[model samples]
Target: MNLLFVASECAPFVKTGGLADVIGAVSKSLATTGVNVRVLIPAYPAVAALVATGKTVMTFDDLFGGRARIVAAQAEGLDMLLLDAPHLYDRAGNIYLGPDGKDWHDNDLRFAALSFAAAQIGLNGLGGWVPDVINAHDWQAGLVPAYLRQDGRPAPPVVMTIHNISFQGVFDGTRLSALGLNADQFTQQGVEYYGKISFLKAGIALSQKITTVSPSYAAELLTPDFGMGLDGLLRERQLDLHGILNGIDLDVWDPETDASIVATYSATKLAGKTKNRAELEARFGLTKSDGPLFCVISRLTSQKGLDMLLDCLPDLLAEGGRLALLGTGEPYLERAFIDASNRYSGTVGTIIGYDEGLSHLMQAGSDAILIPSRFEPCGLTQLYGLRYGTLPVVARTGGLADTVIDANEAALLADCATGIQFAPINGLMFGHAISRTCALFAKPKIWTAMMRRAMRHPVGWDLSAAAYLDVYKSALAP
Candidate 1:
C-alpha cells in the first residue's frame, strides 16, 4: 500500500509532541512492512536545516490558496516530502510560535495552505504515484479530508487520527470562505462547533474513518468531558471510529543502545541503572537518597496536570525524594516549579527548556517517572520511561491507563504487567502514589523485579502499523 501522512510535525526533523513521533516512527515501520509510505509536513525554519540538499521535489500551487513547493528528503531511512511554504512556514521560531512571542493569528491560513497542498499532492499524484490512503494527524491535517470532500477532488480516501480531540481547531465560523470552506460547510452537521468552525469535526464528519491514538481514548471520546464538545458527532460515527494505541521507537529508547544516557543497562543486569541514578543526582546537584527519584519531563501545562504535580511537590519532597524536570510552558507553572527548586535546593532541580539528550538521560537515570495528565490521548514519555526501566506513575486515563499497570499487579502477573496506574486525578492522590512508589523502590528486590518486568514488556510500532494497515485497506477497498 502507498500511504501519505499529512501532519503538523515529524520527529527528528521537527517536533513539539507525540504527533511527530508517531508520524516518523509509523512511516518508517510501514515502509519496513513493504508499504511505500511518504510524509508531508511543513518545512519550518527551525527544521529546514535538517533536510539534506538536492532532495527538493518540484514546485506546486496550493489547491486552496497561495503557491507552495515540496522538498523531497529522507529521515531515519524513511522517504519524506516536505511542503515548503516559506511565506506561511518560514517563520523565525517554532512552527506554532512567532518571533513576536505569540501564535500567529493567521494559523488557520497557514495550516489551511498545508491542507490544500496535501490535497493537491494527492490529486496530482507524487511522481505519478497517488497515495492509496492519505492519513492525517491532528487538527492541522484535518483539513485534508475536508478539502478532499468539499473541493470535489478525485482524491484517495483519507483517514484522520485524532491524537487529542481537545484541540479541535475552532475558528470563527465567518472565516469559512477565507479558509476556502464553502458557507454550506458551516451548518449544524458540518465544521460548525457551537457557532465556530472546528477543523477536527470536519475531518471526523467527512473522512472515510476516524481513529484516535489509543483504544481507551477512543472510548473516552464518546463522553462529554473528554469529547471536547464533539461527543455526539463521534457517537454518531462510533462504528467508523477506532482507537489505535501508539508504539515507541525501541531503537531510540533502549538503554543499552542509547548513547545519551550516562550509563547503560539491560534486563538481565541493572548495575548500570544504579550508576545512572547517581549520575543524575550529581548532574542536578541533588542529594543521594535511598528514596526513589521521580522525574517528570513534560510541558508545564494544565492539561498535563502541572497544577496537581505542583500541589503534590511539598509532600513528595518532604518524604525523602528528588525530582529532575525538563520542559518549558505556562510561566506560572514554570515559576512555581522554580520556586520549589529554590526552597528545596538539592531535592528538586528544574530545567525550563527542552533537551532531547537530557530527556533520554532522565529516562535512563530515574527510578520512577511521573505523568499525571487530566486526559492523555496517548503518552509517549511513559512508554519511553518503561522501556528504560523507569517505572511510570501515570494517571488512569487515555493511553496511560491502557499501558501502565500497578507495580504489585504487574509482579503478580509479570507476563501482562508494566508500570503504575493512579486514578481520581488530584494532588493528594498524586502525592500518595509517589509515596507508594518510594516505598517500593526502598526494597531492592521489588524495585529490581519491577524494572525487569518493565524492560521485558513490548510496545513497538509494528503491531500498531499492522492494525493501521488493516484500516488503510478498509479505506481503499472497493
Candidate 2:
C-alpha cells in the first residue's frame, strides 16, 4: 500500500499537540506493515533545516501566490516530503500563530496551498511515487479531498481524520475563487457551512472514509452536543465513519527506559518511582504528602475544565492531595493556576509553560494524572499515564471514558480497575472522583495492583496501525 499523509505537523520535527505524535507514530508503525508511507508537511524553518540534504521532486510556478517546491527526504526515521514554501511556511517561533499571539491572517490561503499541493501529488505521481491513498488530518489539511474532487480526475481515495471538531477552519466564502475552489459547489451539501466555507466540512462531506481518534468520540460526533454544529452532516455520513482508538509509541513512552525521567521504573521494580516522586517534589516545591500526588499536564483552557479544578482544589488539598501542573494556554486560567500555586504554596505547584522532560518526570512520579476535560476526542496523556502506571482520573467523555477503567467497586472486585472516572463534568463530580482516588490510594495493596494493571495495559500503536491498513485495503477493494 502506498499511503500519503497530508497534515500540518509531525512529531520529533514539529509538534504542538498529540496530533503530531499520532502522525509520526502512525507513519512509522504503518511502515513496519510493509506499507510505503510518506507524510507531507509545511517546511517550517527548523524542519527545513534538518532535511537540508533532501532532493527536490516537485515545484510550482505559483502556489497560492508564491513560487514553491517539494523536498523529498528520509530523515528522523521517517519518509517526509517537505513543502518548502518560504512565503507560506518560513515563519519562526510558532507555525500557526504570529508574534501578537493570534492566528496568522493568511492561514486560509497558506493551508489551501498545502491542500492543493497534496491533491496535485495524489493526481500526478512524484518521481515514480504515486500515493494509492491520501490520509488528511485536521482542518489544516481538510481541503485535500475538496481539491481532489475539484480536479474531476481519477485520484487516490482520501481518508479524512478529525482530530478535534472544535477547530473547523471556517473562512469567508468570498475566498472561494482565491482558494482555487469551485464557487458552484458552495451548497449546504458541499463545503458551505452556515453560509461560510469550512475546510473541515468539505473533507467530511467529500472523503471516501471518515475517522476520529476514539470510538466513543466517533459516536459522540453524531449528537448535537459533541458535533459542534456538524451533527446533521455527520449523521448523513455515519455509515462511512469509524472510530479507531489512538495508541502511543511505546518506545518513546516506556517508563523503564525513558532518560527524561530522573529514575527509571517498571511495574515490577516500583521502588524507583519513590525516588522520582522525591525529585518531583523538590522540583515543584511540593511537600511530601501522605495522600496521592496528582499532576495535570494540560493546557490551562476552559475546554480542559481547569476552572473546575480551581473550584475543586480545596477538596483535593483538604484530603492531602498535592498538585503539580505544567502547561500554558488562556491568560485567565494561567493567572488562576499561578495564583493558586501562590496561595497554596507547598501543597500546589504550577509552571506556566510546558517542558518536555518535566512532563516525563511528572508522569513517572505522580500517583494519578487528572484529566477533567469538558470533552476529549482522544487523550494521549491518559494513555501515557497508563503506560507509566500513573492512574488517570478523568471525566467520562470520549476517549477518557474508553481508556480509563474506573476503579468502581465492581471494577476493583474484578481486578480490572485502571483509574477513576466521573460523569456530568462539574466541580462536584470531579471532587468526588478525587476523593475516590484518595480512598484507593489509602489502600496500598489495591493501589499497587491498579498501578500494575495500568502499566500492563497496551498503549502502543501496532493494533491501530493494523486497523488503518485494513481501512486502506477495504477502501481500495473493487
Candidate 3:
C-alpha cells in the first residue's frame, strides 16, 4: 500500500485553504493504517525552510528544463518530499498569488514543473521507492495525470481529487509546448476547454478515478450549477467518481486538549466554555451578555454566502443576538462586515483577517457557528463547530447536507440532532435559521442536549481514510 500524494499546499508546512488540512490529516491517518503514504509539494519559501533540517533524496537535470531535486522531510507526522525547483517555486509571496495581490503570471509553468516532477517520480522510482498509487490534488497538481499518460510508459495508477472546481488553471493553448505536451492532447475530449488548456480537465479526463470532498458535492458537480463548465465531462465519468467526506484531525481540533482557547471544556463540564465566551467578548470589544453569540470563520466570498449573512445581520441583532466574524476576502465584503460592526457597535464585532488561535477560541466560545455557504464542497468550520459543541447553522448543501442532522422537530425529539440547517441559502432563510437557533438557545436543557449530541459526533478521518483506501484499490484493479 504505497501511495504518493501530489498537491500545491499542505498544513503546518504551508497552507492557503482547507485542501492543505485535508491532505495533511488524511496522509497522516493513512500512514498509521500501515500505508506508506508520501506527500509531494512544491518547495515554496515556507517549505524551503525545511531543507535545512531535511535531506536531498534525489536530484534531476531533465525536469522543466531546469535543475530540480526531491528533498525528503517530515511534516504533520507524514513523510514529505519537497520538489525543490528554486527558479519556479522560490517566490516570496503566497503559493499562487504574487505580492501585488494577483495570481503569478507564470503560475502555469510553476505548477507544470511540479506536475512534471511528480510524473517523473511516478514513472521512475525515486531512490527505488516507487509508489503503487499516485494521488494528485486540485488543479495545482492536475497536470500529473496528464504527464503520466503522455509518458507512454508503465506508471502507477493515478487519481485526481478536485478540492474546488472553480479554479481550473486555464491557460493559453500555445503554452502547451512549454510543458512538453503534444499538440494532439489539445481537443474537446482532451485538455482543450473552450480553446484553452484546462489543467483540471486533463486530470479528470486521464485519471482512472476522480473524487471530490463530499457526496453531495460529487453529485452537484455533475450538474451545470456547481460544475463550472465541466459538467458534461464529469457526467461522462460519473461512475468513476466518488465523494469521500473529509474529516478533521481530532488531535489538532479537539477542544479538550486545544491550547489555543482561553479555557478547556468538554460536553459535561461546560463552565470553561462560559469563561471562554466572556474572554471572546472582551477580545472582540463586545459587551458581555447572556444572549446567543454566533461566530463566522470563513472566507468572505459570494460562494460562502457571506452577502446573505450580511443582509440578515440587522434581523439577527434585533433578536438580541451577537455576532463575531473572522475572515478576509473580496475587499468589498471585508469592508461590509467592518461597516456592520460599526453600525451595531455593541452587538457585532469583526476581525478582518484569519487567526488559527482566534478561530479555535471563537469555536469554543460561541453558542453557534454560521456557515451559509451556497455550494460548499465540504466545510471544515462546521465540522469544527460540531466537535466543539457549538451548533452550526449551515446551508443544506454539499457536506453540510451529509454531515449535519438538522435540528428540526423530529431530530430534536429523537435526540439525534447536531445543528441547524436551512435551504434556499438566502437572507430570509438564513434569518429564519438564526431565529430558530436563538429560540433553541432560550431552552437551556434542549440546547445542552443538542450540544452533547454534537460533541459525541464522529468527525475523525478513520472512515474517510478507509474509503480512500478503497478508491486506491479500485484504481489499481485491472
Candidate 4:
C-alpha cells in the first residue's frame, strides 16, 4: 500500500500544535505497518536548513496551471517531499505569521498552492512515486479532495481528517477562479459557508471518507455548539466518517527514559517520583508541602478555558494545594495569571511561554494535571500526564471524556482508571471536582493505586494506526 500525507505541520521539521504531533506519529507508524508512506508539506525557512545537511531527490515538475519545482528530502529515516515555492512559503517567523506579528493576508493562496501542488504530485508523479491513498489533514489541505473530485480526474482515493473543526479555512469566493475552480462552486454543495468559501466544508463534501481525532469528538461534532457550523455536512456523510483516538509516542514521553525530569520512575519503582516533586518545588521556589501538587500546561486561550481557571483559582488556592502553570497565549489571560502569581507567591507560579523540557518536568513532578477546556478536539497533554503518573482532572468533553475514566468508579477501575472527570466547565464545578480529588489524595493507598493505574494506561499509535489503515483500505476499495 502506498500512502501520501498532506499536512501543514509535522514534528521536528515544523510544529505549532497537536496537529504536527499527530501527523508525524501517524506517518511513522504507518511506515512500520509495511505501507510505503510519504508526506508533502511547504518547505518553510526553518526546515530548509535540513535540506542543506540531507540528500535532496529530484521529484517532479508541478504543472497545475504554472511551473512549481518539487523536491523530496529524507529526515529522521522518513521520506518527505517539500514543496519549494519560495514566493509563497519562504518567509521570516513560523507558519501563519510574518515578522510583523500578523497573519499573512495571502495564506489562502499559499495553502491553495500546497493543495494543488500535492494533488498534481499524486497525478503527475513525484520522485516516480504514486499514492494509492491521499490523506489530507486540517483546512490547509482541505481543497485537495475537492479539487480531485470536481476536476473529474480518476485520482487516488482521498481521506480527509478533521483534527479540529473550529479552524475551517474560509475566504472570499472570488479567489476560486484563481485556482481554476468553477464560480458555481460557491453554492452549498461546494466551498460555500454563508458567503465565504470554506476550505474544510469543500473537503467534507467531496472527500471519499472523513475522520476526527476521537470517537467522542465525532459524536460532539454532530451537535450545534461543537460543530463550528459544519455539523449538518458531517451528518450527511456520517456513514463514511469515523472517530479514531490519537496515540502518543511512548518512547519520547516515558518517564524512565526521559532526561528532562529531575528523577526517573515507572509503574514499579514509584518512590523516585517524590524526588521529582521535591526538585519541581525547589525550581519553582514553592515551600515544601505534603499536599498534592497540581499543574496546568496549556495555552491561555479562551478555548482552553483559561478564563475559567482564573475564576476557579481563588477556590482552588483555598483548597491548600500548590500549583504551577507553563504556557502562553491571550495577553489578558497571561496578565491575569501573573497577577494571581503575585497574590499567591508561595503557592502558585506561572511561566508564560511553553518549554518542552519544563512540560516533561511538570508531568514527572506534579501529582495532578488540569484541563478545563471549553471544547478540546483531542488533548495530548492529558495522555502525557497519564503516562507519567500525573492524574488528569478534565472536563467531560472531546477526547478528555473518551480517554480518562473516573478513578473511584467501577470494579475494573483499579487496573484501567487513570484520572478524574468534571461534569461542567464552570468554576464551582471544577472546584468541587478538585475537592473530591483532594479527598482521594488523603488516602495514600488509593492515590498510589490510581497513579500506578494511570501510568499503565496504554495510548500508543499501534491501535490507532491499524484503525486508520482499515479506513484507508475501505476508501481505496471499489
Candidate No. with top lDDT: 2
Off-target runs (Cα >4 Å) in candidate 1 are: 50-52, 55-58, 61-66, 409-417
What is the C-alpha lDDT profile of model 2 across 420-460, one tens digit per residue?
Answer: 99989999999999999999999999999999999999888
Instruction: Tell me the TM-score of each prediction against the true structure.
Output: 0.96, 0.99, 0.98, 0.95
Candidate 2 vs candidate 4: the lDDT winner is: 2
Lowest lDDT block of 10, candidate 1 = 408-417
Identify the runs in model 3 with alpha carbons over 4 angstroms from their true place.
none
Better of 1 and 4 by TM-score: 1
Q: Which stretches of candidate 4 lie over 4 Å from their true place?
A: 53-68, 99-101, 411-415
In order, what lDDT does every prediction score?
0.84, 0.93, 0.91, 0.85
Off by over 4 Å in 2: none
Q: How do the residues 121-232 of candidate 1 rate in per-residue lDDT, one tens digit apiece?
A: 7877867788889998888987887777777867899898999887887788888988988877787767787888888888888889888899999999999999978899
Q: What's the TM for model 2?
A: 0.99
User: Whole-model lDDT for model 3 versus the true structure?
Assistant: 0.91
Per-residue lDDT tens digits for candidate 3, residues 293-338, read: 9999998999999999888888898888999999999999999999
Q: Which residue pairs in candidate 4 collide?
A: none
True-vs-predicted CA distance for residue 329, candidate 1, Å: 1.0
